[model samples]
Target: MTTVGFLYPGHFAEDEFPRMEVILDTTIRLVVNRTEPGEDDRRPDTLRTLGEPERLAAGVEELRRAGVESVVWASTGGSFVYGWEGAHGQTTALARAAGLPASSASLGFVQAVRALGAARVAVAATYPEEIARLFSEFLAAAGIDVVATHSGGVTTAAEAAAWGPDRLKELAVAADRPEADAVLLPDTALHTTAHICDLEELLAKPVLTANQVTVFEALRLARRRTWAPQLGTLFAAREAPPAPVGWRPAGE
Candidate 1:
């Protein structure tokens, strides 16, 4: 089985890893963020505080130990909350520290869009307005055009994670724009693998969600481009293999 990993940055609302495994019908290894001594509450602010390069590097190290073929920093805002440059460095540190292929949910979003040949996308964010705005900026930096965006003003990961498939469908349609080539739901806390195709059928456009793209990016990084179609159009993509990046062990 192809095993994937994620550096989860907060207390998740759902047991997301196992769900992805069931839907994708594969193995998913995960490393949740641990609080240091005297660490603050497990909230959005805490996720940001814990998103430092060294701290994230440590988490990736653990995922490597778990035998993850590929891993992603599976927190949307944590990956992009610091902006494009910072997130880039965070994934770079993860690759170097884990000596495994690494990607972030935020970076995965950008790459996913390009892979889908989508230039214009509408964003459905669970973050408050401020954090949602930063995601727009990060996408812009990646050269993807944001045709429209919406923020639900959600305050925490647990809250976003608690949303069921119905809510996920509602959010994606609400965020869709007539001009957008696709709709993006940028929250790793959310569970969308179950409803990705349903959302796409409703919107008649590609619907990319955090968990789906994170897995896709991990599979790509780990040399598992050949995937089954049940995950979503993102996985059903039968294009030629993405150019492979060289893999090196940590501490090279």
Candidate 2:
């Protein structure tokens, strides 16, 4: 049985687990850590504390012991710190530590944009407006143009996890731009994957979210071909799986 392990904060969208289970066919096991909200722990905040790499590395080791075949960082902000190289290096490090393949939300977002052939995109974020700037730079490095952005200023990881899917769709529609060919919701905690097909129908374009891309990217790395309408266009497209035994780290 192939296994995918997700490392994340204490809370997350209730919708994500069900979606993952159906898409991955009961191959997913969610492993969680503390929320670790710092001084700015509020209901509507986006300031995320960078989790210690040492702590994350240890967590990956535990997942490996549980027979996980691949691991994914389920938090967007936590994995975006090292920029492109940082994101790649961190996943490689975790893969080495766990003796399994690995990936992250941010790096996966880049791949999804490319898979969709999206040149200019509008991003809807669950983070504060300030954090949106960081993602814009990260996407630029990946050769994606940020045509527009909107932030909901969600403060805590718990709150982001608790946010309703209907509300998130509203944010995505509000954040979309007429000029963009695609829309991205860049927070794993926001639970936007299950709504991707709906969003596409509404906006008439590709819709991507962190968790959806994260899973797709990992499956690609593992040479697994997955197609799920609920997960959106990235998965809907048919492409050759990544070469086995030489999975380049994410963002490479």
Q: Please, what is the whole-model Cα lDDT of each candidate in the order they appear?
A: 0.73, 0.69
TM-score, candidate 1, is: 0.84
Runs off by more than 4 Å, candidate 1: 25-47, 240-252
lDDT of 2 by residue, 1-252 (tens): 556676765555535755576665454444433334344343213332454456567677557666666777766777775677777887888778777888888888887777766778998887777677677778888888898889888766667777776887788888899788778888777767556777777777778888777777766666677656556666664663331223221112
Error of 2 at 112 (Å): 1.0
Model 2: residues >4 Å from true position, as ranges? 25-49, 240-252
Taking every candidate in turn, the Cα RMSD to the unseen true structure, in Å, is 7.5, 6.6
TM-score per prediction, in order, is 0.84, 0.82
Please estimate how well model 1 matches the true structure, expressed as its whole-model Cα lDDT: 0.73
**Deviation from native of the Cα of residue 71 in model 2, angstroms:** 1.4
lDDT of 1 by residue, 1-252 (tens): 666677766556336556666656434343444323123233446656767777777666556667788778877777787778888888888888878888888999988888877768999987788778888989999999998788888886667778987888778878898888778998877877667767877877777888778777887787776554556667765683232123111112
Best by TM-score: 1
In candidate 2, position 86 carries an lDDT of: 74
